[model samples]
Target: MPFGGKARWGVRSTVALLAAITGLFLAPATVPATAASAKQSSAAKALAGKYVPVMMIRKQGENLCDTKVEQYQVMTVDALFGNPDVRLMRNNGSSKSTLIKQAPTIDDVRNRGEEAYIDLPGDPLGDTCVYSKDFTRMKNEGEAPVAVYAHIAREKGHSGIALQYWFYWYFNQFN
Candidate 1:
């Protein structure tokens, strides 16, 4: 299912959206042979790290009832799906989850956009404390610190290059 209102799109950790917009002006109208090769260089990949958002977490209220865990993480898509506890759930009428082949690879993600999510164990509406602990445990279990999937558009004869990055988070906690 669509992540509902819990999904966050914030300035702190969403540089892809901003960089993509900047690329519009910075990218040349046409890439020459040399320029095309340079475009494929490590510089483009390096830019993703530079552009990765610096997420800021707000503290939970004194009662801790106002919110769940204040921690928000950006993890490698693989680290999430590769974890045994993380299940690849099909977004459908039925709640049954399909077995992913050791979790989907980057190529698989490109092929199956929005088709599935790495669902952590526990109810989506579970207690905030429980979710908070689970998130902590998952992080402690060696989840990757960050991941950004970058794609340089490959359209034949395309005028300008379109650089895009896709970030996958463990959970999209709106609160």
Candidate 2:
């Protein structure tokens, strides 16, 4: 009775047949590794022992809603992990802010040979800031700040190769 037609196969059956065919062609196969796959595997093997931790802070010229915030000086992994000169300070406010005295550079992240951590601050309205790293720039331009971290992570066995697409907007006026 569906579609008010006399067709031999129903809509559901046609859709299922098409979906199964699509899945068969789209799923990854283990046999016959391509050159790109080989390269990714090699890179993953090379990055099996390093890790990096990063914290995001307000860059100069950003609005801070008139809140009193302390600026930290730039710090390296050695200065933060090896030396005892700097200490982490925590605030008792509702935000429970952690004061970081320095932000790590992309190069600092790449040169790290051990485990790492990343800390992104929460926005003023309580929305959390999400951090992601991609290699699109490196693939196209041979380099990018975030790609350094992604490559290192791949080299250290911390993550695997993946393709991602991202859309960014300058402002979200509608929330």
Candidate 3:
């Protein structure tokens, strides 16, 4: 029951959602070879517009349990991609991270580009309170909290594809 019952849960709707979420829209159907592709892309974008979620964020500066967790921002994957401050890294199998690129694009991520993970600026072993504070500031600087990464995965011998959504957060305080 997401999107306030505006978008239905179905294969076609899912495709539209994918197009919208990924920001990949189809071109015009002027050419004979790309007629179908253009039509589908246009339709998907139109339908996806209704499904965009209106996030409800907690009041900023609100304190609860001696913490200001409400100030955390919920951001989009587009916000993270192409961001100069974010670094895309890959593991070198020796407990070392190799820098693949700075601010990899969504297309790079969708295409399974070189970078497997993104490294934030703060130190992981630093104090929790300090990390939280720095993360909040970082969030305000350019990053938001929630960026969803989705892909269609097909298991071997499986009947259909699985729409997988991975929600990315900057810092997990509860962890």
Task: Estimate every model's Cα lDDT from 0 to 1.
Answer: 0.50, 0.28, 0.51
Error of 1 at 47 (Å): 3.9
The full ranking of all candidates by lDDT, starting with the best, is: 3, 1, 2
Determine which window of 10 residues in candidate 3 has minimal summed lDDT: 7-16
Regions of model 3 farther than 4 Å from truth = 1-38, 46-73, 107-110, 113-115, 124-168, 173-175
My TM-score estimates for the predictions, one after another, are 0.54, 0.19, 0.49
lDDT of 2 at 113: 36
Q: Determine the backbone clash count of candidate 1.
A: 1
Task: Return the candidate ranking by TM-score, descending.
Answer: 1, 3, 2
lDDT comparing candidate 3 with the true structure? 0.51
Cα deviation in Å at residue 1, candidate 3? 23
Residues 20-104 of candidate 1: C-alpha lDDT, one tens digit per residue: 2243224543744365544544455555545443455674444433456454456554555445565555676576667554444
Off by over 4 Å in 2: 1-41, 45-76, 94-147, 151-175
lDDT: which candidate is best?
A: 3
Clashes of 3: 1
RMSD of every candidate to native, in Å, equals 9.0, 19.3, 7.5
Question: Per-residue CA lDDT of candidate 2, range 1-175, in tens?
Answer: 0011122332111000111112112325556767765565444433321222233434323332222331221211232232233333344455564544335544444433333333333232433212111112122343221211122212244454332222222122234
